[model samples]
Target: MHLVIGGAYQGKLEYAKEKFNIKDEDVFTCTESGDLPQGSKCLYRLELFTLSCVRRGIDPCGAFSDIGAWSGCVIICEDIFCGVVPLDPLAREWREATGRLLNKLSPEACSVTRIFCGIPQKLK
Candidate 1:
């Protein structure tokens, strides 16, 4: 999988689309339900998916145990763990879990890119 991470409004999805030649039909925008389209070429809003898993008391990593399924995918997640920490326990846990999930996937990713102000920086 290729990982694309950045803060909100950083153009991560746009960059992915340009780089991967992705089409609207090939992208799956995740929601607060832990629902992942295994066949989608681009998985966006992954942070929200983690929040859904946390709310459901489910291990998000378990859903991605099969690396082969994502081997050729582009995964985009927001960097929600930055700046001020949330006071709510649920928010904190969600942030931490998202960080852990990204860390776990980073090394395994075919490439890891971080977007900042519309600029893409390769990290892996």
Candidate 2:
């Protein structure tokens, strides 16, 4: 599996598409409907997915575990734990859970990259 992480608008999705040769149609963005695309090689905005899971009262870790089972999948999410901590409980929980999920998923990933200023730096 591959993990691409960065702050919002840092071009993580563009990096994944260029590097993986993934077409726009193949990329799946998490939504309130919770309709994840099965068999997709790339999944983006996992931070939003974490928030969606929290809003639905679902365990984000478990959700990530289930998604991570798809080997060779490219996961894109923002590093949400940085900057000012949210005053709202739900927002805080989402940030913390996203960090935890990334921690759990990164070790299992064959490659991990962090993007900044549209440049990707490999971490694993």
Candidate 3:
């Protein structure tokens, strides 16, 4: 599995697409109301999926494990835990949840890349 992370609007999705050679049709945009298509080669906006799971009273990490197990899957998520701590309780919770999910995925991922200014830096 591959995990790509960076700040919002940092070109993580484009980097993942180029790096993985995934076509548009094979990419899954993970959103609150959307479901992951079975055997999707790529998943983007996973931070929202995690937040949605939190709001729905579900364990986001556990829910993600199944998707993460897919061979050759590429996951793209924003690195939202940086900078000042959020004042809102729900915002704080979402930040923590995103961090935990990233931690859980990093070790298992065959490759992890951090993108900044359209540049890719391999982390693992």
C-alpha positional error of residue 106 in candidate 3 after TM-score superposition, expressed in Å: 0.4
Order of candidates by TM-score, top first?
A: 1, 2, 3
Per-residue alpha-carbon lDDT of candidate 3 for residues 1-124, written as tens digits (9 for 90 to 100): 8999999999999988898999998888988754556677988999888888778767778766674456678999999977799888878888888899889888889999999999999899
Q: Which ten residues in a row have the lowest lDDT in candidate 3?
A: 62-71
Q: What do the candidate models score in CA lDDT, each in turn? A: 0.91, 0.85, 0.85
- Return the lDDT, model 3, position 86: 85
Give the lDDT of residue 32 in candidate 2.
51
Write the residue-wise lDDT of candidate 2 on 1-124 in tens digits.
Answer: 8999998899999999999999998888887548456567888988888888888888777755565466768989898877898999989888887888899888888999999999999999
Model 3 segments more than 4 A misplaced: none
Cα lDDT, model 2, residue 49:
83
For model 2, the run of ten residues with the poorest summed lDDT? 63-72
Candidate 2 total steric clashes: 0
Q: Candidate 3 lDDT (Cα, whole model)?
A: 0.85
Best by TM-score: 1
Q: After superposition, how far is residue 15 of candidate 3 from its true place, in Å?
A: 0.9
Residue 4 lDDT, candidate 2, scale 0-100: 96
**Better model by TM-score: candidate 1 vs candidate 2:** 1
Q: Show where candidate 2 strays beyond 4 Å.
A: 33-35, 66-68
